[model samples]
Target: MLETLVKNSRTSVDAGVYEIRGAARGGRSIKWKEGRAALITEVKLASPSAGWIREGADPEEIAASMVRGGADALSVLTQPLLFHGSPEYFARVRRSVDVPMIMKDIIVDEAQVAAAEALGADYMLLIQSVFDGGYAHNMDEFIEMGHNRGVRTLLEVHTAAEFERAQNTEADLIGINNRNLDTLEIDLGTTEEILAGRNTRSRVISESGIKSAADIARLKKAGAAGFLVGSGIMGGRDIEGTVREMISAC
Candidate 1:
């Protein structure tokens, strides 16, 4: 499934034209709120690990609930096969939410950056592991493409070594995904383990396995400027309350 997504993304559109078409006008900048850890609540339908997160859930409604709960930013999963996400869902969330949004997907090509911008996303995710595994795409190129199209970039890294690689890029925002792609397992320690004693100007975001206020505090102490939490809120019965509690925890 991963290979197929990468293959299709590589040839899905003409990069040059898509870059031009991706140009857009406005989006809210991600500024961490005072006295609270920046919260980037996500609109995810499913995942390869959890599966069927919230079947038939409405992305726009979820986004609105998140905003009401004081989310600083939003992330919309755009991967279709494994995550059951779509660009249309992203567009809806963008229209409904008045916050910075990151188009979270397995971005393997520059065209995906174009797609994110065309859909009005404020930022696009770039996974270093994808390129490290010998993919033909370049992260720097995609970063430049997003900047040209009026979008920012969030480079994701899962390991300390990957964090080192991320430092090589000009990406200003960095995310540490606690969920391991290979094992599909999550450990809160992953974020701290990767960021321990590290100093950099980039904003560090901890993703996944954020269940309670304590968890948020732990990550904050570990040096995360913000968090990208999804399933905890999306899979819960009370999304608004969950978002509020998570924000308060931060």
Candidate 2:
């Protein structure tokens, strides 16, 4: 999956699918409202594991619903092939919502960073494995690129080693993703297991497999300061109410 995702990213970069904007408006801070219940709702359509998770849903509507449910920020999947995502979706949702957004792509190149800036995104997702596995530029370099382009970096780590390395960077947020990219599996305890006995000053956002307020509360006890929920809200029968319930839990 990583190989194919990287290939697709490189293809997009080579074809100049992402544009670099000259000037960008400032991005909203992830720490909009304090408390353990900070939420970053996502606008995702599909994924390799969950095919067609929310097909035919408008990005603008999803984003608005997330905000109405008290989302501090938003995340939009922009990978074209495996995730069935597009930069266009990011742009549409970005224009419709006032909250901060993170462009959730595999991000194998600096070009993607520029693209995020062009779309008015406040943050861009940077995979620790993608950089650690020699698939792209150094994580520091990518973080710097994001800074230079007027967007913050959200360093995503799945393992203990990656989490350890993430704290060393200047990224604005460290996402402990429950979904392992290599295995395509989901574990709600990934946040708890990874954060056990670890004191981190960096902002840690638990990603994936978050379903209800209980899930948020458990992750909060695990030392997660924030939550990035996708399918949990997008797949729900009532998006706004689902987000509201989960947001209130933490």
Candidate 3:
């Protein structure tokens, strides 16, 4: 499924670039203020591990709820085949909320970066491991493409080696994903294990498996500047109330 998504995305590179060039650009810039762990709530519809999360969910409604709940930013999944998301979801949510929106997808081509800009995304994700899979081959060029379009890149890494490689890039943010892609297992300790005894000035965002306010506080103590919680909030009955609790914990 991942391979097919990468193949299809690469084939539309030129078209994606052309579309973004013709589209207007302007969105809220993220400001990670001190004294709180910035929250990046996600508008995800489904995943391989969790299957359909919030089936038939409204992206705009969920985004607004997140914003009202005090989310610092939003991450909207755009991987259609597996995640059941589309660029239109980002656009829909953009119109509903003013917070920074992240184009959360397994980006494999520059065209997707352009699509993100055209869709009004304030930030886009670039996974370091995908380079090994023949996607995002030119890491520097990929990062530059987003930067040139005024879209900040969030370099996501799952291992220590990937983290090391991500550190060399000029990414606006660094995300440490606790969920192992292969096993689909999440361990919050992964965030601590990687950040232990490290001195990183760059903003660090802990991703995956964050369940409660204590989880946020633990990561904050481990040097994480923010938290990206998706299923924990989206799968819940009350998104706004859950988000508020998470924010207050931060």
Candidate 4:
């Protein structure tokens, strides 16, 4: 995946187009509102399976719209291959918006974390499936490396076992990714399953498979601190208005 991402990124750059990697730096602090689920809107251009979302969609315009629509933070898809996004887009969006920006990429190395921090990212997403131990670090040395650099980590988990491992890590936020990376199949019940029998103190963020405001409400009732919405907003014709409705529903 990393190799494919680099190749695609180079190609896009060669074509004089920027990607959305490391795009969340230099934004306001991430706030996990008490008793309310915040909306983390995504600024996406295209996807491997879904193709282009609003062809020629301007990153700055989308960011501004999300903020105006009441998004608490902005998550820009930074993966170049699968998502057709770039690090440059992330930087531009961060500069254009006041909301906290999260670098949404398939982070596999510490260098990527450093790059995100250098780019002014407020948060870094670490998918459990990609991590060796399904956390930022090994259980014995569970340190929040990214957090120390002023970048919070959102540990993505899909199963109960992964959720258990997340509990051991010192992640500030826990993201329940509804879509299985291996199959790309979405299961809305994943959030409920993960939060079922856990004593997690970390803030919860429901990710993927969120198609409506009712879904947000359901997750909020399940104790999710935020909603990581990507496709729903990106796939919509009116991205800004859709985000606003989702926030109002929450």
Q: State the C-alpha lDDT per candidate.
A: 0.82, 0.86, 0.83, 0.75
Q: Model 4: what TM-score? A: 0.85
Model 1 weakest 10-residue run by lDDT: 14-23
Give the clashing pairs for model 2. Answer: none
Give a tens-digit lDDT track for model 1, residues 12-99.
Answer: 4433323434333445689866666699999998987788989998888889999999889899987776788877788777767678
Candidate 2 runs further than 4 Å off: 20-24
Tens digit per residue, CA lDDT, model 4, 43-120: 878866578876778888888888988899999877676687777788888778777888887665555666677678
Number of the top-ranking candidate, with lDDT as the measure: 2
Give the per-residue lDDT digits (tens) of candidate 2, residues 162-239. Answer: 999999999998999999888889998899999999989688999999988999999998999999999888888799
Candidate achieving the largest TM-score: 2
Ranking by lDDT: 2, 3, 1, 4
The TM-score of candidate 1 is: 0.91
Model 3 ranges off by over 4 Å: 1-24
Model 4 pairs whose backbones collide: 19-86, 20-85, 20-86, 21-86, 21-87, 23-90, 24-121, 25-120, 25-121, 26-120
Candidate 4 residue 238 C-alpha distance from true site, Å: 1.8
Q: Which pairs of residues collide in model 1?
A: none
The count of residue-pair clashes in candidate 3 stands at 0
Q: What C-alpha lDDT does candidate 1 achieve relative to the native structure?
A: 0.82
In model 3, which residue pairs have backbone atoms overlapping below 3 Å?
none
